[model samples]
Target chain A: MEVNHISKSFGSKHVLSDINLTFEDNKIYGLLGRNGAGKSTLLSIMTNRNFADNGEVKIDSEDVSDNDSKLGLMYLMSEVNLYADGWKLTQIMKDSESLYGGFDHQLADHLIQEFGLDVNQKFGKLSTGYNSIFKLILALCLPVRFVLLDEPVLGLDANHRELFYSELIQSYSDNPRTFIISTHLIEEVANIISDVIVLDQGRVILNQPVEDVLAKTHSVVGPQKDVEQYTKGLNVIGHDMMGTIRANYVYGDLDDRILPDTVQLSNFDLQKLFIFLTNQYEGSGKNENK
Target chain B: MEVNHISKSFGSKHVLSDINLTFEDNKIYGLLGRNGAGKSTLLSIMTNRNFADNGEVKIDSEDVSDNDSKLGLMYLMSEVNLYADGWKLTQIMKDSESLYGGFDHQLADHLIQEFGLDVNQKFGKLSTGYNSIFKLILALCLPVRFVLLDEPVLGLDANHRELFYSELIQSYSDNPRTFIISTHLIEEVANIISDVIVLDQGRVILNQPVEDVLAKTHSVVGPQKDVEQYTKGLNVIGHDMMGTIRANYVYGDLDDRILPDTVQLSNFDLQKLFIFLTNQYEGSGKNENK
Candidate 1:
């Protein structure tokens, strides 16, 4: 799937601007951004739920606009509940099968049992966590090449969230397909995602493999003076101070210099990187381009 | 605050069974449980939102039931929104001040600006994340001895959640109060919470200081044969196998003994410990009485 020069605006505010990205098949992509950072907007335009003011979306080199065949290949489980409130969980599953075709009944049944969800229950009566599970079940069972999930684990408990991740990995291994997961729980999804696309103020600020992005950033903690002197010229994104100790998160490559006995250096995870990057953009107007 | 032998049942379903716990002043407690494990029920009973079939809750040896003075000292920021839909943020804060007697308007104003929330906006108009932030601001600002936060970070993003944790630490340092935070995001609250209460199937399975609980369990990984030999007769809570490699998570004390060269050991986090304990109960009917 490809999004070409996608730009969107609501009144005078630009939600997304010239966002060009491509998602290759059979790889998991993490669509990450701060709140109101155009993640949902870009996804909506890609899935054709909302129209973009400029550019277009393509699937298999064909325009997705007004194209049922192309749209059929993609499935987006958004935060908003689109299903009718009157429908039961079982009925919703049947409806999805009828619309998408080849709904994996076996997987659906397995997930329903695993999550301990009552199929007879009404959609409106389900709790917040259960509501998320219901949508996730539908998304997983549907036979779609490209699946885009927005806040998939929004209300899921830790156990359920863990189960969902394992189940997702299981299903992906069984059937390789493109998945674009947009979520606020960065650490939970950090390991599962193959590539990351970070949006900031309607612009693509960072896009790279998870490992590569993590490799460039490091957290060096030690005596305040020594740490500051060591990271003086590095692209320091953020830092924390406690008593006389200091921890500086430095982005970009670090020089192969001898470290002090008291200092300790470790790699920065996705969550820390996202915080520092977005925090930098908000703080000092430092935006990195890909 | 203390809950003595609290038990509740609706029809034949026992929602809470003999839950006796105490919340000391000036400490944070992480109330953790799986779905349907009775976390919400316990919180409701503690806050007097729902009545327990037996036993009572007390503040300083005085029964909280029907005692306005005692109840006023505690507050529950629940998942269910208590504020009216038409009320603005400022109005809600004012209402809270009038009711609670000492709402910190300065702190509330600071939080509102920090989260980029508009006090003029109606409560219903706020987004999911903002709604959580709105409630969190009130929880932090209100001058109460005990605060019960149920899923406080429900719809929060990474940056906002991080901000909330830091602010919580800051406020707790300035004004020490008892905070019982019930949520499924264990890793996020692990470091912040002083103690943990793990409820499972209407029972309090574990309750202890964070450091003590973490010290009791460990995960040892190595070859299947070597790992099994080393962990023989040990309290193995959970184990996973991949080819010839095995990772066994053992609870209770690990003896100081020499291990195989390939075997490695590490601590089990709050989330992993909760999952294993809960899984153990459901799988083997072994409930440790600690």
Candidate 2:
């Protein structure tokens, strides 16, 4: 899917400002950013659920303006509600089969059994775990080539979240399709992503391969004097203090001389990277590309 | 807080079965499990919001069966309500102050500015990000000794979630309090926690210092043969396949042989550890302690 330079606003408040991004086929891309950074808006425009003030979205280099089948190229922000209130689980499977061409009833049925979801119960009253199981079933069962999941693991406990991750990765691999996963739990999803696109203040801040992103961001903890000297040229993410010992999460290669065995080093967790990058932009009042 | 052989059941469903836990003072513990793993059930029982089928909870060795105030604890489980729809932000603050005994008006006012919340807006109508901001503000304003947060980052964007973590760690440093944070986002919160507890099947599975847990867990990824041989006799977390190359995460030492230059290793991410530990428990149908 190709998203041309798009802009959106609500009256005078700019939500998405001149955004351009593309999702290559058959790979998972992590759509990341701080809250209110216009990720949802950008996603909305790409899926054609909401109109962009300017710009266009293309699938196979053809516009997705007014075509239902073409719109099938994408699915965005999926969560629970596999069956609404008073609806049976099997009814949802039927509805999905009717809506999406790629809907696989066999897969859905198989998943329902695997997850221990009762097909007879109304969907609204399912437990939180069951709700996530239902969403996972729908996401995996969808016929769409581009599946966009926004916070799909919200109500899920740790076990279900991991299940969803492994299942999503496995299904995406088997199907060979583009998957855009939007999540706040960056580090949790970091290792699974092939690519990542970070948005800040309604614009793309960083987009690169996952390993490169992780490799470039790191942190160091040690005595304040030694850490301060070693971190002179490094990008400091943040630091903490305890009496005299200070742990500074700096973002650069360490001068090993200053960082001995007593000091510790860790790759900056993606969530912190998100925070620091967003804070940098917000402080400078300038977007990365701007 | 010490919970002594607590049990809770609803109708015929046993939510919590003979659970006993001792949450230490001045430590941040991750109360982890899958959905419906009885985390919330156990928390509710400890807080007196829900009566246990049988058992007792003590604070500082004093029985908390009939006393709630002296516990000096504050619990925030996802969204309670800021009442923002019709009420002003100021009005919402006033309302929350009355409900929490340790409410600090000065701190509340300071956090309102820190989060950039609009005081004129109605409580129920704030944007999702601002709603999270409000909850964070409420959490910080309270002067409780022990704060329990259950999935506090529920609807937050990455930026807000990051800010919450930094401020939370700082708060713990300044106040020296016990924080029991329950969330599925493990890696994000790992840095802030001093200790870890992984729960599965309504029981504590892995509980120890974070450092101790990480010592036995590491991922060795490379060629399938090397990976297989290296992981022999160790607890395998999970493995992924990319053609002939398989990357396996294992729990145990990696010092048998010098790892090949092609093989990459990393300290076990907490999220992975949580998933592997819990999934292992569920699959084996046995508790580690048992």
Candidate 3:
């Protein structure tokens, strides 16, 4: 699937601007961004739930706008509730099967048993965690090639979140497909996603594989003077100071300069890298294409 | 502060049962639990916003019920909105000062500038993340000895959450006070909190310092037979299998047993320990007093 020159605006505000992305086959992508970064807007446009003001979305050279067969190939489990409030879980499942043409009843039953969800309970009466679980069950059991999950574990506890991730991986292994998950919990999904797409101020800032992104970032910790000397002229995105000690986060390759005895270099996690990258944009109030 | 034999029930459903715990002075406690685990109910009862069916809350050996002085020393920042919807940020801060007798206007101003919050906007018009930021500003600036924050970083982004944690640590350092933060995101708070209190099904399952709890847990990874053999006679809580490799999570101290060359041992984080501990209770459907 490809999103070519897509742009969206609300009144005078631009929500998404000339967004271009391509999601390859059978890979999990983490769609990440801060609040109001146009992640949800882009997802809605891609799935045709909302219209883009500019370009188009295509799958296998076929435009997805008003195309029933093309739209049917993708499933988007969003925050909006499309089913009636009075409908039970069973009724919702039946309706999903009818609309999607087929549903994995065996997988649905397994998920229900694992999550301990009551099928007889009404959709509106479920708690926040249960509501998320129900939507997740539907997304996992659908027979679509692409599944887009927006805040999949919104109100889930630690244990439930673990179970959901494990189940998602199991289902993906059984049936290879594309999964694009948008969530605020970056650390939880860092290991699960093979690729990452980050949006900032209605623009795609970073789009690459997880391993490639992590390979170029480093954290150097040492005395203030030594750390600064070693990281001079490099892409020093951010730093933290405590008395005489300092830790500088570098975002590019290390030079061949000999390391100081007082300094120690290590790898940083995705969350820390994300914080520095986004903070740079906000601090400068300017968008620099990467 | 002490919670002595507190119990609460609503329509034959017990929210908290015989809960007893003590909070030492100038410490940060991570109050962890699943949904409907009575964390909010307990905080409300402690702040005199709600009445308990049994027992009482005491500060410095004096009952807090209907005691203005005692209640004044502690502040509860809850999910419920206590201010009028039409009030602006400045008005809310002024009211807080009048009600609490004093407020840190300097700190509040600094936070407002850092977060870029618009003070002229009404309380109801702010977004979810800003709303949380406003409440957090109030909680940090008030001149209270005890502050109970229930999901203080509810909708905050990663950058904001990191900033909040740093400011919290700085505030605690400047003026030593007790902070009881109840949240579902455990890994983020694992390093910031001094101690941990876990509630499972309205019961106090684990109460210990963070280091003490982490000290007793170990993760053993190797072949299935070797891992099981090494963890034999220990409290094995959970295990994960990836093809032939198996990882067993042990809760108690490791015995002085010989290990195979292929086996590896390492310390697990707080989130893993919480998952294993909580899962043990749910899998058995029986509560054993620890």
Top DockQ model: 3
Expressed as tens digits, the lDDT of each residue in B42-95 for candidate 2 is 776677777998989888888776686744465555555625468787776676
TM-score of each prediction: 0.94, 0.79, 0.95
lDDT of 1 at A36: 90
Question: Each candidate: what lDDT?
Answer: 0.88, 0.73, 0.89
True contacts kept of each: 0.65, 0.79, 0.68
On residues B139-234, what C-alpha lDDT tens digit does candidate 1 reach at each position?
999999999999999878888898899889888987899999998889999999999999988999999999999998889899988899899989
Provide the DockQ value for model 1: 0.47
lDDT of 2: 0.73
* Sequence-dependent TM-score of model 2: 0.79
The residue pairs in collision within model 3 are none
Docking tier of model 1: it is acceptable
Question: Distance (Å) between predicted and true CA of A178, model 1?
Answer: 0.4
- Going through the candidates in order, what is the number of backbone clashes in each? 0, 9, 0
**Maximum-TM-score candidate:** 3
Name the runs in model 1 displaced over 4 angstroms: A255-263, A280-290, B255-262, B280-290
User: On residues A1-290, what C-alpha lDDT tens digit does candidate 3 reach at each position?
Assistant: 99999999999999999999999999999998998899999989998999999999999989999998999989888888878898999999998888889999998998898788999999999988999999999999989999999999988899889889988988999999999999889999999999989998899999999998999889999998999999999998878776678888898899899999999999898888888888733445111211
Write the residue-wise lDDT of candidate 2 on A1-290 in tens digits. Answer: 78888999989988888888878888889988776788877877787878999989888888887877778767665542434587777777677767875587776775565556787877787876676677667777888888887777767766667666766766776678888888877877888888989988888888888877778776777787877776778777666666677766665555545556666778876777777777643444122111
Put down candidate 1 lDDT per residue, A40-144, tens digits, no spaces: 989889988999999999988999999998999989998778898978888888888888887998888888878888999999899888999999999999999
Model 1 chain A poorest ten-residue lDDT run: A281-290
Candidate 3: segments with Cα more than 4 A from true spot: A280-290, B258-262, B280-290
